[model samples]
Target chain A: MGFLEALNYPIYVAIFICVYSFLAIGLNVQWGYAGLFNAGVAGFFAVGAYTSAILTSPDVPGRLGGFGLPFIAGVAGAMLLSALVALPIGKICLRFRGDYLAIVTIGVAEAIRIFARSEEWITGSSRGIQNLPRPFGDLPYVYSQLAYLALVAAILLVVYLLVERQSASPWGRMMRAIRDNEVAAMAMGKDVPFRRLQAFVFGAALMGLGGALYAHLGRSITPEAIDPMIASFLIWIMVILGGSGNNRGVLAGVTIVWIIWTASEFVTDQLPMEYALQAKYGRIFLIGLMLQLVLRFRPNGIFPEFRPTQKDSRKPDKSDKA
Target chain B: MLDFINFYVVPGIVTGSIYAFAAIGITLVFSIMRHAHLAHGDMATMGAYIALAASTMLGLPVYFALLLAIPLTAALAVGTDKLFYEHLRKKPKILTTMSTLGTALMLRSIVQVVWGVGTTSYAKGITRPNDWFGLKIKTNELITLLALAVVVLGLAAFLNRTRWGKAMRAMSDNRDLALLCGIDNARVITLTWLIVGGLCAISGFFLGINTEIKSMMGWNIILPAFAGAILGGIGRIEGALVGGLMIGLVEELSVLFIPTEYKAVSAFAILLLVLLVRPRGLFNGKII
Candidate 1:
């Protein structure tokens, strides 16, 4: 491949990174900052993707089609739809901690997948929906690619800015308190459940946004495309490798993981037939290797360890009274 | 009367029994370790593949093949706990739950690696039909159902009568007290893996015999298994048994009114409803 074509691969991979990094930031906000591990990011991701596809697909009438809204509208719809779903999911999930929440989220994602498969009216079922509308129809493929990239990048930047500002805010501080010590936070009247739900719902919305972008890029949507293994684990890996609580670390993690993922895709093509077939099994091996290494050596992750601030750490054990 | 007895009730119980097999392992792992073992499906998958290899390659009788798989799968589970989970004991519970996902991925890859990426079927001779009261049961299915009953009885006896079982129960109720009382956490954890792996292997074998052996086969019904365990209450082994059978029956019988494609609907629906309305599970965490 020539230079631009070679550049094509990295850029395509970067597209996934930029979108994924947005999600990692949200997850960092939830699990890294507030300690809510959500294994159902895939569900929200699918919700967002399908939302945009259904709204913008040429085939679908009424409901959401024909307005010819900008890509931004689809992005907004994705976030809103996903967040809407997450509200109820969050309600149920926020009540449980530890494994209960983990399994419940996985169940929710699978349930969504099953519904998506069963309800052919909403999603196109196993056949999937195709020909998703791009942001600028008049533009060429390369410009469209670049425009879409720019669009996602712009959204990522906006989210990063907003989340950054929030993290620096009082709400962020209280979220950390709740995560570090739920009982103490509850005693202090921090609205522990509400805060947890907010973090989870918000993070899930970002997952939706990423999914919408991914659907546009691939130009097709299918239940087969929605594998929870890759969708959930890869994001966790990114958030961890990047430093769960740190946005910058998450950005780095997404970039590195996506690159590694892309490179593996290329490198496997060069391997012998059997080895190639072995490597073809979806991104599980790479994701596992990263988690194993991260857990073994750098449990805190590649960025810095997320530590409670001195102010928060010094707070009294008010929860003990309860 | 015949429809209720022949069509509805018996089928529900049979499928529910299959689900119970899965629930047993899931409940044990969750109760003892306090994390949802996402790798449970893959362990079942691995076991099914092992049994497939044994029965087909070695020319062993399928019954002996299944018997061989139970111990082999249990050993794998113990090794998995020692390697991955033991270290995770000190970490936060949710993190470990996410970590089991990594283990799940790793295990599936290993399954795909050892047994190529295709489906394997039990030999026809072994899977042939056997008449039991004119019910037209497959020899494989009946053997699986009976094995499940025997295993359930065996496990109940072990838990009620043995030191390890009592310790496991105490640990599930309160880990801190169990630890303080000089209960060996390591042994209970190891034994937890042992039971989970054993039943998971049996679940996998019958699944292969009833359907087919594929990497994702165990996971396909995982939600139902989750339904079974949680419905039975997390720590209660008997709850898992009943829960699984109930879930299986519901799933199988739903096909009468709905498309077979929507079969997994019961598992997720029951799971979501139970989680929402009865957060403690159907049995309300009732220890049997």
Candidate 2:
């Protein structure tokens, strides 16, 4: 490929990285801070994608759509729909151990997938919904992509600031406390399950936003557009490898993992015809191996969550000293 | 009623036997090792594929190939435990569960790569069902039911009557106490994997015998098998057997109400219902 063509590939990947960063950040809130396990990240994502598609896509003859809402309205609808789905599941599963949540989430995701494939009126069956309007779609290809990238980055910045601020606030501290020791938190009269449910819903909403961004970029939505297991697994690896509790680390992790993931896809596509299929599987095997290595060698991840020093917290405030 | 008995109930029982067989293994592993073996279904898939290889390449009869696959799959299961899970035993059991999800993907991918993605069957010609006084049944179905009975009885016998089985039971009941009493935790774990692996092979083999062997078969079974385990009670072998059969029956009978394509949803629905109503399961399984 020529330099400009190669540049095009990286720009596309960069857009995905931004999209996945939103997912990883969402997962960080759930798994990292609240110690909730959501194995169905793709479910919330699909909900967001389809919700936006239904809300914003122009009128179709047979299927549900043609709301013709603006892009921002679609994004809001995506987040709301995702959180709505998360609400009941989080309320029920958060009462038990995280493992229950994991299983339920997996089930929920699978159900979403089956529904997407079967509900023709919703997802348009196999053909999928198309002609999703992009922000700068009328511009030349390269400029449109760059514009999308800028738009994604702007959204990511706002999400990052909000999440960081939340994690620093009393709410984050309460979540961490609940996760670290639920019994102790309960003893202190904290509503453990409710707090956990909040984190779970909020995180799922962020994942929905990521999905909306993805749908707008691709200009379409399909049941098979994303491999549920692989997408969910990749997000898990990003959160775990990036330092679950750190947003910066999550963003970094998403960039690194997405690059490696897409780079491997490029390499696998280059193989001879017969071996190419096997190469796809070989890549999955390597990703699994990567998880093992990370868990064993560096369970804490690259940038472990920065637990504020005990001594610093103990110091009296300047106003109190005065 | 007779038609229902012949068509749905018998098939459900056969299918349930497989699920129960797999769930027994899952329950055992959950009780002892303390995590859902998400790869259990995949391991069963591996077993089925190995049998296919043995039959296709070695020119063995399908039954003989299944017999051959049993030991091979068991050994592989043990090896997986040693290679992947042995180290993570110290960490939270939940982390081990996560690794198994990855392992499940890797195992399924390996199967797809080695066998290719297309569906395949062991023997080309279809076998007619043998009518036994009006209840039509296939020989393989009969064999599956028999094997499930034998395996469950043997496991119960082993746990109650044998030394090592007692050690395993002790470990499951109370690991620290078992250790304090001088039980070999490592040995029990290895033995646990052996039985679990062997059972996984049987379930997978039976599933393949009844259905076509496809790369995605294992993934499809994971939810139902887990549902069976949890429904029967996570740590109760007999409970899992019952639960597995219930799920199998519900799945088959569900077609009467819903579209066939949504069959897989039955298992998840059963699982969610059980989790909601009686998380400890019918037999009062360990709550962990």
Candidate 3:
């Protein structure tokens, strides 16, 4: 019995790791490559979750949704809606530096939360949209979970390959160049704001896809499904701690942080009845403390950005002398 | 007309005063430290908690608790800056803002662990508003407005006339020039945090007095405070004050046309409009 439970536990953790890896990869594009600070990961995630939930879930009376669309269409809808939300926000704030983007994204996230909570016609108010379709629903519990896990892993692999290829392409180099030196990129005649917007919308779509996957896994979407402060901030920590520009580092970071987070949660759950709530909050406090420590001690994270080799560095060139 | 003043204008001014007070701290930090103090609202929650501790544990009056909270919160604010933010001063200012978001979560979690996630008031029981010249106002609301007026006036005088305030302004104007002119950068930063902490306490205390205190109150107020700061101009104190009041009025008046649940949308709309139309703000604040 204990062996069965242990096997199930790691499987659950693995599923979550896959979901969070998608978010961290999305953030890697925005922050690592494009130098955009998106504080509203939860917002895009919610949009995706809701879009998929509304599309796939059967009709509930008095609600605006219940399209009964196919699962693929739902996922696509999630990504498309998330990008649609990102477009206006990126257009308005991408013209400025990252500071404005940070605050505006936060505000936009709050606005989305407000709309979800208040717009009962769409979000079903406090009761939330339910009965979302799950893949492999007819199988045994463990097998169903395993099947969903495999599906998510396959999606993560595809996203990972696509992002990796993009990062190696000329567009990725131009993004990094713009991030490092906007004036130099501008002198080269690149439109900085437009490129940043593309990355922003693209990254948001990935986050939305992550959300859709999570919604389908849970078979529900609610205002409380994603805690903006905790869920969104956790993804930020993953990307930052993993080494922002390195995709492998992001995957590693997600696994480590998720383990630590869940391990702490397990310990807190073991506490006596009265202290459980306090312990839960204490765990939150520690997550925050960890962020500060990592920022101070390992600002470049475990795996710093990898630079390509240049053969001519053994001798001083004319430009060096000048 | 009387009903309008009693219902909307009075409450608007009271709420606006709270925003103005908080925005002052935000603007001061932005101007002097060159970063958005994203933890500003959570710090206010800390102050309110400190005051709650003072009142409950020591049996101090609510106003006295506010006074006690100022110095304590200032010390804490200074400590956080030295530990978390001071090192980041050499980095891009925006990174400091990011760290402050972490700080906000940390501060709020600390509050939650200690106080739990329940609402409480400084002094219990309802107090009915008094009528004067056909205008109804709560005594706390009256005191809030008066205190705001005095603080704003005193702050303006200090900025324009006092030596330390002038030094702060000099730093805000140009950090390198201020250092070259022999102003103490460390002293100015500490002083700014001190004032910011105190103002944060005042605003938090007033908010607690007017409404119940809760762990999430600070988070809820942050966007409005940011809206006010941006509306008035980021670095300009007077602009922040005016902008805060305007936001307060607009938020209250918005209830007339829209659902009360959508009140925050108005503040966000204001923020976007300001960002798009006049990023420098109404007072033509420093572009930086």
Candidate 4:
């Protein structure tokens, strides 16, 4: 194959990496910083993807579309709608324990999947929304792939910088404080529930944006594309494996896990049909096994959370104590 | 009304019994271990598939196959705890919950690989429902209800009468206090898993008998099962039973008011409503 052809594959993979990074970063804000367990990442992701698809796709008879909005509006609408959905969910579930939140989120995601599959007028019902506007789609395949990669990468960088800034601020510190010791944080007058809701909604919006980016890249948004195994659990593994509290670590994790995942698919494809199908499941088994091992041995992940040391002046003096 | 009772309520009670079995397992684990056992559904799936193998491959009868599966699934559940959850005992409880999620994925993948993701049953031909006083009830449905009654009564007897069961209850009520009382925490935990796993297997088997056994069957029911568990009260087994039945009835009867396609939403809606209005559950279960 030609050099550009080889480059094309890498570019496509890179675009996906960027997309997954968005989800990982979003999850990190919830689980890593705020200690919120959200098992329904795919639900919010589907909401985002479908919202954008409906917003941007050309008119389709018997379905919700014909807006023909620009890609930016679609992306914005995706984030807005995802956040809106998260608001009530977070409000209700965030007050309870983390496990409750996790189960509720799973239910919500499943409900959303059902809605997308059955509500034909809204989501085109399993067939999904088609003909999404991909930026620079008319360009040649290789160039277009590269251009999309650049676009996603640029967006990822901007998101990374903004998130880093936010996490480094007092808000991040308060979130960590709440996560580590909820009672203590509550005592310190940190409106605990409200703050948690903020994190949950904010994280969901980012996930929605990631979905929009993915939908546009594929030029379609299908119900099949939003499976919980890939869209939710995979992103979870990325965040946890990368180091949940660390954005850079999560990005690195997205790169590593996505590569392993797709690379294994390539190897499995070369196998005979039945074995190949088994191999696909085997890969999931391995990933799940990998998670157990990771949680067991290295719970903090490859890059552990960095705790800033307090100044010595804040330490109690031995002489004064004596 | 008679048609609704036959078609909707009968099936509802049957499925509710299945969910009750699953919910009981979930409530047991939650009360004893203090974390949501996310793999409960997949463990049930594995149990159903194991019974499928026993009946199909080993030529055992369906009930005998289920008998074989119960202990095996219980052992698997206990082993899972030993391998994956043991080390995380001192860590945050949420970590163990996440580990179970991973376990869920692992168990499901294993099922998919072995079972080929296709629907299967013990027997190919469909059995006609026998009419009982104007109510149409399948033989399997009657079997499910009887089994549920037997399991519930047996469990109640065990919990109320046995020393080990009391110890398990003590641990659920107060872990540290139970430890102080010289109760063997490890043994109690093992016992809890044994019961939970066996119950999960029974539920999975009933679901298989009632409906087609597909790879995703357990997964699809897990949410409603959780709703049932929470609605009845997390630690209370009877609560799970009532909650499971209620959820099943609501889901089936929802077809009256809404499109059949949206039946699953009823469980989720009930879950949200219960969580919002009564986090402590119907029977005053622990908030956690």
lDDT of 2 by residue, A1-322 (tens): 3665667877988999999998899999999999888999999999999899888999888899999999999999999999999999987788778777888898899999898898888889788889888899998787788889999999999999999999999999999999888899999999888889999999999999999999999999999875675568889888888888989988888888888888898998999999998898788777777777777777767888888774486466755888
Each prediction's DockQ against the real complex: 0.49, 0.58, 0.67, 0.79
What pairs collide in candidate 4? none
Q: Write the per-residue lDDT of candidate 1 for residues A127-191, one digit (tens) a residue.
A: 77778777654576566666778887887898999998898899888988898899999999888
Candidate 4's error at A28, in angstroms? 0.7
Tell me how far the alpha carbon of residue B24 in candidate 3 is from the true structure, in angstroms, after superposition: 0.9
Worst 10 residues of 2 chain A by lDDT: A310-319
Candidate 3 residues A1-322, lDDT tens each?
5665567878899999999898899989999999898999999998998999999999999997779998899999999999999999999888887777888888888888888899999988778899888989778778888899999999999999999999999999999999889999999999999999999999999999999999998898889987886558988888888888889999999999999999988998999989998999887778778778778888867886676743365356756888
Count of backbone clashes, every candidate in sequence = 8, 1, 0, 0
Cα lDDT tens digits for candidate 4, B172-212: 99999999999999899988998988998999999998998
Model 4 CA RMSD to the hidden true structure, in angstroms: 3.4
The 10-residue segment with the lowest total lDDT in model 1 chain A: A59-68
lDDT winner: 4
What candidate 4 gets wrong by more than 4 Å, as runs, is A309-322
RMSD of 3: 3.2
Off by over 4 Å in 2: A1-6, A309-322
Q: Is candidate 1 or candidate 2 better by TM-score?
A: 2
Better of 2 and 3 by TM-score: 3
What TM-score does each model's chain B reach against the true chain B? 0.92, 0.97, 0.98, 0.99
